[model samples]
Target: MHDATVIGNRLRTLRKWRGLTLVELAGMAGMSKTHLSDIERGLKALDRRSYVASLSTALRVSEADLVGGPHLTQDPVQAGPHSTVPQMRIALQTNTLTEPATDRAREVGILTAEVKQLEDVFARCDYVTLGSRLPGIIDELHFHAARPQNEAAQRDSLTALVEACMYATFRMKDLGYGDLAHQAATRAEEAARLLGDPVALGKAAYCRIQTMPREAGWDRKLTAARRAADTLQPHVRSAEGTAVLGMLILTSALAAAVAYRLDDARDGLAEARDLANYIDDDPCRNWSAFSITNVGAWGVALAVESGESGGAVLEKARIVDESLLLGRPSRRATFLADVGRGLAREQKTAKGALGWMLRAEGVAPQRIRNSPQVREAVAVMIQRSKVAASGRELRGLAARMGIPH
Candidate 1:
């Protein structure tokens, strides 16, 4: 039997439950009846964020309902990373800016070093370690920031808290704890505002945009990214400022592309490329990963979202310096998974898409397993696979993602 949790199954069930026909849902979502039908039948991949956002809006449900998020699995490797979410949530909820939940904390310098180490862990996509360590770090940082011994110590503690909270935001989001992720983002923004640092505030803005409700708010997300980018443009004389500004522009480009604004997306990409030319690829710099190669990686995603042909998308992916992506497993895996997603759109290239996805999984198993886009692409490819070898390969991937094949 086909899995009831697959996006197609969920979509069909939701539509019927709402007493809507395919034509009605499609009309509401700004798509054709035939397209909606294909999606319901699993012939078409429901991989586009824009499509999910539209359908969720039309159905008056959250995007997570359609995507079946907070996906629990028995496999330890896949399920282990999510184990710490409850603890992290408690820490975030119980703590405050003026009064932290913890009473004692290490020195500011030690906490700062630990935060840096956790940032490295994040870059490697080591979510298990990242999640396990975050709650303690968060509480400690909060204690230090809230109970500062001196003005300099207070500034240092607040700065470390912002970075720690940002890391927590990323971890929560990746593990599908959207509400917790938003709380983490809010904490980060609060710390940045207290510090009165423009770059820190820009980083916090990026975190907020990432955690914004995916069901709607495309315009709000895009506007926020553009406004943050504009505010940071004057600070680009330093590498850190340039990288953060580039990151914001890339965020704008992605928000535009997902909103189906091709012209705006291209303009954003063009502007990002110009900024990227001024800096080197430094994954640690503001954690932006903004560089010429990263811009190319973003281009592949934009092309895929724009409904460009598979060959065209592959052409865009070809120019990105894959070597530059190695240090940041999250960025590297995302780039590879997006390439697979784009190629899986066409039957002619679907067979080859599996290889790229496998590479992505090898780079970051948790990320690939949790990604709705990657999961839907795998489902579509499984439905299309005829050869026994490819079928076996695709089924293995599906099983890893807890999707029955």
Candidate 2:
């Protein structure tokens, strides 16, 4: 049987349970009565994530129910590498110190190059390769930090450890492992403190801000971000400091947007844009992609997330060259997902939204698969595929993702 028919049946059943007529549900969902009738008759399907979200909201049901299964209920932490934290902690605690002093300078140079390599891999969005490499790098740095022969060597090892842990924190956060990400950030903060590097502390703080609980509220998160950025602003002569401060401000804007504080979001974005003006784009500082163009891209995402929709939001996004976004795979993927969502909010079909989301998935499968938004987008796509022929590709993709047919 066509899966769309099954989805349509479920939706119809839900509406009946609520004692709502087709016209009533359609009115609440802000769709045409005829279109809603077609869906109830299994002649059409829910084709957009926004549509599914809207209908579910109107019906007082979960989106998962409309889609006919609990595809989204899986615990990401249990299903992924969250359990690796204890092992990583053990590696840090048990590593042996570096030996002797003859090749300390050469070894430092090698470790620096390795850190660069790791950053490059991260920029490319090669999470699998990064995951495999992190343990060894963490152990090596810890080993060196434990047994450096002199002060200079100790600083080198400590710095390398901070870099590695920061990368670990970034990857863990991307994968949606909040607790593990927070642990990595904590380790990075400790190392940064021992090194007495203010710039490094700013970076660690940036990672910590993401792992903060939503229960803590946006005011608390924004305050923390403001304090970190303000502290780094005076040290703005250094490129690293400038980048960290700009990013912190940008992050504050994101937090404010999520909390519905549009005024605060605007203020933070303006400050970040001003800071971005004074800083040059440094490729080696991959995290510093907080350029003016990047700020515009983020502005588009923030607008979409705020439930504002019109030609203006998508138009603003269009002016940002796709090439600029491609330089950072994570940013590129997120920007594309936001664009897809904005398109959907504009009443585009599920296929249109899926096109944008699939483009992001093609570049970074882990990113898309791990995203709740993409999962719901895919759920809508699958529901729309009721006729069988039109949804074949999406069905194949869903099968690969272990979404039940």
Candidate 3:
């Protein structure tokens, strides 16, 4: 995508050369001050067509000359008066840095936003460049927290800080920066506790899951997930609230299944199922599309974790097939795990469910691969695949990865 800032800088430079103030330029171009300033900054994501017309009109440069310049895209433009401001390239943000808000739905929004931004970075920014700013992000989160604001605004900023922390933590993990991620998650919990909201506390609890040993950890994670999931129950009269509660319960169920707490997982899933039914039946429900499918998706994961029973596999398949995950990466990961679990049941793959495991990995790298949701599947896949059979790659992946074995 073409950076508006560079084009804006070009326009600013040309106007200055003509000795035009923004006021003078606005008159010349028959545009407003805001419009002129907007054109000068790269905040706008203009395409080729808009680029030509706007730059030609505002910069007073010939379209041919504008197009001919080397600074046409997000690709680096040479340093000069008409160049782009260098955007910050930060290192992988650890998961802890990207904390969920003290509210349920906002966490989804923040994570979703980060996932989208990551896609852009992968497409345009150099991996090495984006990999250098982890420490700065952590610093910024605390700095932002210390600034003064009204109570409501302060809460909102805290939410943003938590989201940033979570992103940093995940980025740190994906880039193999465990110590940074661990530190960020630790800090995130402290911040979330300050907020004292169930949703935030839950996220704070789950954030530490990655730091603990597998057997001893999931239990605490499940406890935290359950508390968070159940936190919205008091407000569940509304269909949307019910759906949100379902999601929290669903999270707890996942942890329970991982910890081999089949009874607990079953209870949560059953409750989630009832909530999903109400959300579907109610017309006034304010649930988003993701909110609706979140529970069913969890059910599928839980089914797999619980070693899918006689009809549970088919039910999950049918349910997931009807899910909102038309092309969703997280959904695909869930589906892949379900498939892998099914395969495991039938002695389907001698290579140990390679298809599902590989697809989960494939679907995630561009989507939510670095997310907390994807790890359980990966752990199950690796363990089942027997990749740890004294292989060089297995030891390397386990030892190098900060994930508890």
Per-model TM-score, in order, reads: 0.96, 0.74, 0.50
| Candidate with the greatest lDDT versus the true structure | 1
Candidate 3's C-alpha lDDT?
Answer: 0.48
Candidate 3 C-alpha error for residue 120, in Å: 9.4
Q: For model 3, how does the per-residue alpha-carbon lDDT over 202-251 read when each residue is reduced to its tens digit?
A: 45444555544232445776786676565646644555456556656776
Candidate 3 TM-score, C-alpha based: 0.50
lDDT of the structure predicted as candidate 2: 0.68
Cα lDDT of candidate 1 equals 0.85
Candidate 1 structure quality by residue, lDDT tens digits, 42-84: 8789988888889998998988888876776676667778877
Candidate 3 off by > 4 Å:
1-138, 149-153, 169-182, 209-212, 215-217, 230-232, 235-244, 277-292, 309-315, 349-362, 366-405
What lDDT does the true structure give each of the candidates? 0.85, 0.68, 0.48
Worst 10 residues of 3 by lDDT: 77-86
Q: Write the per-residue lDDT of candidate 2 for residues 85-177, one digit (tens) a residue.
A: 455545444443443212223366577678878877777667666776676677766656666668897788788878888778877776555
Give candidate 1 misplaced runs (Cα > 4 Å): 1-4, 284-286
- How close to the true structure is residue 251 of candidate 2, measured as C-alpha lDDT? 86
